[model samples]
Target: MYPPATRAAALALLRRGSSLNATSVALGVSRATLRGWVRNAGAYSPRVAARATCPRDRELDAGAYAHLLGLYLGDGCLSEHRKSVFALRIACDETYATLLDECVESMRAVMPNSVSRNPAPGCVHVTSYSKHWPCLFPQHGPGRKHERPIVLEPWQRESSSAIPSASSAACSTPTAAG
Candidate 1:
């Protein structure tokens, strides 16, 4: 369990758009503990969801982004490490090595059967590294620089889908393909 002060700091960091991993690092707490706090803490009340509107001009230069996207999407066989790096590229021009590590761990958790070729206890990590996470995400990278992606409430997804709306345009920034 987190102390009240740590919990408060974690929530504040999260509200300020810090990634969960960022919040964990800032608070010096384990990611799992921080996640538990986020899930179970009633201290932070949910606020009205806000739609972030980008200015009319291209939020990201299309030509440059297309080139970057092509680099990653072209070969169609990007390694997990490369995909994570590519996502970091779009995310504030720097990769969050910590988050990338976590993503790899998660991929390990879901390793496919064929990759179970190894009967060792820690074999999943290797499998995850080789597997491509195509289609796991519709969007490419993490959220904007210095900020984390907002955790959409269940209602938000339904609401967003009901209308094939302009919000789609907001993601004009280049993102990873897989």
Candidate 2:
């Protein structure tokens, strides 16, 4: 077990706006331990969650993210739960197992976590929950997407254009390996 002093130092560094990686490096603690400390202390706010899990805070795999973004804009929706957590749900046809796996892979590439596959009559709802979905996919992830003002950012346009149109996956990033 880590000492309480060490835990406090880690938390202090995190609260002072240090990235989890930076905090762990500076204090010689694992990122998992730091994340657990934050979880145990109930500091899962959006900002905290984003810093901890957002790909933007680290070396982002632009190609994977671009594919995921394309898939999301075309077929996914976001729902907000308590504690500011959001769920990104992509509807996939159950018959296409390869497509389902691809969706799950891209989601993990963007943010590492356990993604749930909810089966329906003919489709699977592939979902992963996080408090930073809106931050990563700010265009649409919460509420009725039709009600929201959707505008594609220039970078998103360029990224999507350079990619193989959402169905093809690409690249590797330093995932948390959950």
Candidate 3:
């Protein structure tokens, strides 16, 4: 597996109009491999790296986020291990689980409101913070809920099916009926 940093470097070069064939030859990697790396890099890079800033600003929301974050920070002990998981993983398992739960819940509560509307239209800094903690924490970020279809009751389905087609439904509008 290619390291993220090296892959990022390769992607940067590729984005600068470098040919995949040339890059592969210079980097001593297959053209297809280089292309794959670039594709993966694009998957994680800021969604709007090339686009202008968003029209909706959130400077005013800073106070609200900070207040919630402060409350969250106050819940944990100051001396607790908050570094790499490998380091923390070596510590007590129970403690780690508790801290993980607290962190994930705190994040889930604060981020969706602080970040942006459903499916953020542009890159947001909250994504980076989320990367640090992901465990049953809805890693896809806000506005991106897992799409599981709701099981409908047979009667409910049949009742809905009895309704007329969309065109007829529209024609039943109060003004059209009058």
Candidate 4:
């Protein structure tokens, strides 16, 4: 099975008006495979279909949603280990235990089914078996998120705007105030 990230990238490329052949070449996937992915995108995740139908309706709180989006842009990625299970891995340096805790907290807030595990010394895996991961974190593209343009959907923008102050406060470094 193709990685959810790769499939997401293919969908992104196609959404930008790229031809099927071009998307296949850019993603290094077979034309038939790309076609199959396009056909199956909606069926792969019911949440994706629901989101497309109603963008304003969301399950995550504004603050946690914004935090999850930022985390996905920075260090998170989606991978499919099996035909039915997808894992969202966020790389975290071991020294930043607090950041890892925040990631776990945000993930739990967004997707309670997610479990945070330390796969390596400097990485944390917030893994789940949900097929909707790609739909939720669609920033996967040709290169690093920094190197590519990350555009938030209208609903995401509205949701993010709702909690900018909270997001900023949560993202700030803690200081010892005497």
Candidate 5:
């Protein structure tokens, strides 16, 4: 184990505008270790890899997944963070409290992870952290979502099509408007 002095020195170099690669090379420490140190500076929280839950593994909640997908396709983005973790953020109007709650519910129903609502100036960012978000949402990419070509995977196509339509609903008695 390296001494605390070594860790402090490495962090000091990093604070002094040294890149992770350069700091590792100069301090004789591995980049992964440096990342771990940086990730857990104040407190050491072990990284617990989430379980593998995908369409292939089991049946996805079609209704909730479809709802989440719609919201995602509208104003959502998946950002990549350190250690291959991804944060899914969906923007909803701050005035719509039900929408923010629905967003959080859909995310939890889909991934059953920790979902948070971060309030912005005029909107709220409903975010969830997971490693499998990219796998679930194939449309995520760099730059604006509209700028990228959104071609769904075969599984996504099936999921979207699985959404129940209201065509089957038939009323025995017609209303005055009908």
Candidate 6:
């Protein structure tokens, strides 16, 4: 049996979106052991119940949100998993190395606690255990965004219209020929 502190630390890490394997390694415990702690902790821990609520209420960077929105439009999707866990999956072709970097950077900029993982070949998943993910990426809907009409919320529309000047400037900046 683990000490209360050890179990708490393990649960804390898991609550913050750490994977079972990662948390187990950090706590020097087997994945099965950690899983047991998680299962038990859920029965008595407030944090388990809190997971169903929004992580935070704060303003999002318009530029970063715009970039994330663009990425989503191109190849991203938001999915709901068991126990209120939500994930944003951006499908990147393995051939485009830079695309994955961009997606990872964009996700990190928006959700610092989020960690990107490769759940499958050529796909990067940015997942969090927050109920507020839908608030940040309001593009969540019933069907594929293209098949159905994607109506943006007022804030999304405003942010999209306000894509920063730096983005436009970067596009216009001339590159030197080697």
Top TM-score prediction, candidate number: 2
Model 5, span 121-171: residue lDDT tens: 567778887767887887877677767778878877788788863011111
Backbone clashes in model 1, listed as residue pairs = 140-176
Cα RMSDs, all models = 16.5, 8.0, 20.9, 12.6, 12.9, 10.5
Best of the candidates, lDDT: 2
Give the C-alpha miss distance for residue 1 in model 2, angstroms: 14
Q: Which lDDT tens digits does candidate 6 get at residues 1-178?
A: 8788988888777766667777778889887787677666542223332342233344566777777777666566677755645677666555556755665776666665455556554444444334456777666767676676667788777877897531211111111110
Give per-residue CA lDDT, model 1, range 58-168, as digits (tens): 133333233323222321122345533211122211133443343233233322212211222311111222212332223334433214443434533443444432121
* lDDT of each residue in 65-150, candidate 4, tens digit only: 78877766556666665774557766665566687777778776665454656566434455454555666666654455565677
What's each prediction's clash count? 1, 1, 0, 0, 0, 0
**Residue 127 local lDDT, model 5:** 85
Candidates arranged by TM-score, highest first: 2, 5, 6, 4, 1, 3
Q: State the lDDT at 125 in candidate 4.
A: 52
TM-score on alpha carbons, each prediction: 0.25, 0.68, 0.23, 0.54, 0.62, 0.56
Show model 3 residue runs off by greater than 4 Å: 43-178
Model 1, C-alpha of 32: deviation from truth (Å) = 0.5
Q: What is the lDDT of residue 46 in candidate 6?
A: 32
Ranking by lDDT: 2, 5, 4, 6, 1, 3
lDDT of 2 at 36: 84
User: Candidate 4's error at 161, in angstroms?
Assistant: 1.8
Q: After aligning candidate 2 to the native by TM-score, how far in Å is the CA of 90 from where it should be?
A: 0.7
Candidate 5 overall Cα lDDT vs. reference? 0.68
lDDT of 1 at 83: 30
